[model samples]
Target: EPEVTQTPSHQVTQMGQEVILRCVPISNHLYFYWYRQILGQKVEFLVSFYNNEISEKSEIFDDQFSVERPDGSNFTLKIRSTKLEDSAMYFCASSRTGRTGELFFGEGSRLTVL
Candidate 1:
């Protein structure tokens, strides 16, 4: 099946440094989103983008997190200033539409703060 791809499966960053996680969403998808899991925690939604702008963003998507679709196929999450709390598995997801839409998620980009 066609799939979304993420890079640098694992990354180690300092308490306050910028980090960018890359993703290539499925070719035909119309909506893109970012979610995170803090080790043993449940998956939490961060943001969703569509048609070149943000459609919806959760409270967790604070000033620290930003997202962009630099190219037709590429979506990225950039953390301007990382924190120890930022350590988690960042998952990139895409869907066609609707509330009941089934999202397809990348394996994940694991971030480690030290």
Candidate 2:
């Protein structure tokens, strides 16, 4: 049984710093996505990537945010400038298919900005 793995499960950063969350999904899975859940708020989609390009993105993924698959096996989300509002649990997910398929999520990387 394969699962997604995220590094640095917990991260604490200053309000104006930068942060990068990393994820490695199941080897055979294709579509990958980044979603976040602010404390006490509902989970929200941030972005989706496939074939090395962005497939979909939410308004939350603004100029301060970017994503990349630097290596075939790893996917990452970079926050250029963090804010108090950026604190959240960021989840990385992957699915065998695109929209309609079941998505598998990582345990999540918790980001805390002070």
Candidate 3:
């Protein structure tokens, strides 16, 4: 079965820097999102995109965060400025539809801001 794929399984960056985490969701799924989870905390929703636009976002998704679906295939999350609090496992997930479909999640990209 097709699955979401993320690059640079682990990334280490300095605080106040920029970081881009990339992902390719399942081809047929439409709704996409980025989620963050600290080592032992519950998952935190960052943003969700559908129909080529942002559907919803959380307060945590501030000016420092942005999402893009540049090529109709690859979806990316760019943190214009990374902070220590940004260190976490960022997961990429998708659903066939925005509401009722089960979400499929990528293994996740680990971002470590020093």
Native-referenced Cα lDDT, model 3: 0.93
TM-score against native, each model: 0.96, 0.97, 0.97
- Model 2: number of backbone collisions: 0
What is the RMSD, in Å, between candidate 2 and the native fold over all Cα? 0.8
lDDT of each: 0.93, 0.95, 0.93
Point out where model 2 deviates above 4 Å. Answer: none
lDDT of 1 by residue, 49-109 (tens): 9998989999999999999999889999999789999999999999987364699999999
Stretches of candidate 3 off by over 4 Å are none
Model 2 lDDT tens row, 1-114:
899999879999999999999999889988999999998889999999999999999999999999999998999999998999999999999998886659999999999999
Using lDDT as the measure, which candidate wins?
2
Model 3, position 86, has a per-residue lDDT of 94
Of the candidates numbered 2 and 3, which has the greater lDDT value? 2
TM-score of 2: 0.97
* Alpha carbon deviation, residue 100, candidate 2 (Å): 2.6
For candidate 3, the C-alpha RMSD (Å) to the true structure equals 0.8
> How well is each residue in 1-114 modelled by candidate 3, as lDDT tens digits?
999998769999999899999999999999999999999999999999998899999999999999999997999999987999999999999999887648889999999999
| Candidates sorted by lDDT, best first | 2, 3, 1
The CA lDDT at 5 in model 3 is: 92
